[model samples]
Target: MSVPHAKLPAWAEYGLIPLVNLAVAFLISGLVVLIVGESPLEAAYHMINGAFGRGEYIGFTLYYTTTFIFTGLAVAVAFHCGLFNIGGEGQAYIGGIGVALACLSFDRVLPWYLLFPIAVIGAAFFGALWAMIPGWLQAKRGSHIVITTIMFNFIAASLMNYLLNRVFKPLGSMSLETRTFETGGQLPKLDWLMSIFGLSVGNAPFNISFLLALLAAFGVWVLIWRTKLGYEMRTMGHSPAAARYAGIKEAKIIVITMMISGALAGMMALNPIMGEQFRMQLDFVQGAGFVGIAVALIGRSHPAGIIPAALLFGMLYQGGAEISFEMPSISRDMIVIIQGLVILFAGALEHMFRPAITRIIFGLSPKGRQAAATKGA
Candidate 1:
């Protein structure tokens, strides 16, 4: 059956579905909190306070937001391209190697100014390279990307173990091969940013990576909406035959999109290697590639939609940590329970809420719409 075409204003279509999903995600989170024998209301308030009420807290939350955006954008892009590029874990693993090598190579040879960009570009390229082979296989051999990428994930994990054990192993350490970046290779303090606010180290990890994530999100928005390439991707996603009929090369675009997707995943290195930590280690990220799927679902596969979704994940994750520390009775795994429920609701919101969940406006109410229109006019 041909899909019925329903074109709402971009705001109504993309904006509405995600807003509905967000409400559902939060509701699920709340119920989980209640089930944990905690007051949902108080837990939520504490979560918000831990995330943003204090200056340091905001920085930390942004720290989580930065990398989640990278991995989530990776997943979102592949979803739009009609490909489930599930190899984000592997790509990120490979990227860690790239960043580590770049940091090591440039440490004595280059200045901090040049080394940072070098490391970022190197990480992204390596990430893209890791993803390209599976993309090629899918396009050429009609392989299932999900299966291929999952296999590659094992390969990536194995490769990480090998490299840390052999190639990148610091001479003395046998414990999982984590080596610190040379001082020059380390990400510099955001003295310049903090200088402006007169709040030195307001948040240690809230560095330039946050700015880059926001820019990348905006860039993804423009790429998917304003660019011809993105339109082709969306078309391919909806109907590959129609896309081919429209003169789009499905194979080429698929491979390219996966490369971009993997590259975005590789950018995950920055969250750990370029923040206060300044080096990539195996556990620097935690199942980020997998969680990215949840992020994309919650974000409704739109770039702008990703922001709050990531922030929500960040808050729960941060709150989970604080809760574990303070309560002693609760463990961090409880947050995982909340996250699992949120994902369930976001994924099944339509079934859960049915029709009435249809007409909710999140940030843009009717009054806000009029204000926006009047201002634009």
Candidate 2:
């Protein structure tokens, strides 16, 4: 007879396990800092102070958070449908093209309010269209999503390069970027929102897009947990055979889910392009697409979990920059190492400490101990 193992409590599974892993990661990272001849506690203080010490730093952190939130949701949504859509980088790149087309063509005539919606729709449509190719391949041709999506990223980069250099480059301009967007195309700053609370953010990039990201999170929650389509997607993810028995069309779900994921990733372009750069430029994505994978894993592929995870990464990014500037001993590469450790612990090694923790929890719980005793007999 096989002995049954006791299940961990929800709190231990969701809460304690992650905390222990994070602590271990940080502890290891601290050792790395010490080895490099720096004080770990001082580094920690600098990171915290840099990320949230001032109103401006807070704004920058939140600005980064907005991009991660959209991409993380994109990853999470597809994960729910059992799809690994790694094309967020490409989707976001094409989405920026869509936004640029809409803004450049109509910014002179349309009001900002009217233009913004058009830009958003363009971004979503183009993103979905780009992703449709990979989705169709996966659904119809049986192509693996991971391979196709990675290829699509390279394709997107090349396409954008050609467009920016040959097609959209303004006359008499040497830069590999489009002409500056018209005033009407620009997104208004949210400094007034801060001012309402008697705080100033000192020209940070945080904008209305932050609110849109939050709304997207709520929307993802509803789409995943409260809808029939979501149910079908989840069912398909759990078991294709069972889903087929229930008459859920796996192909349709795969395609639709990927398109939705692509759309969310595309929306991330709005923050950097319209809100910050005010022009279409090369490399605006800055690897936020890839970062979504880490965010999704750390967040456990849930919208509620994704928000805090995105914010945490945002803090790491902003704080990392600050510490690198202040402490020459802690280079940018060192900061990346620290970030890598977090990702490693949160994702790949997430369960490394789970068994030990489970035993401890089991020891402390009467019901758990009783179950273990019964199983042993």
TM-score of each: 0.86, 0.94
User: How does each model score on lDDT?
Assistant: 0.76, 0.86
Candidate 2 lDDT, tens digit per residue, 1-377? 24234567788877787778778878998898899898989988988998899888888888999999999998889999888888899999988988999989998999788988999888888888888889999999999999999999999999999999998889889988888888767888788887887768897888888888999999999999999999999988888889999988889999999999999999999999988999999989988888788788778888888999899889888888888888888876665675677679987888678768867887898988887576545
Span of 10 residues, lowest total lDDT, candidate 1? 354-363
Candidate 2: the clashing residue pairs are none
lDDT of 2 at 14: 76
TM-score of 2: 0.94
List model 1 lDDT by residue over 48-97, tens digit each: 77666665676677678777888889999999988888889888878887
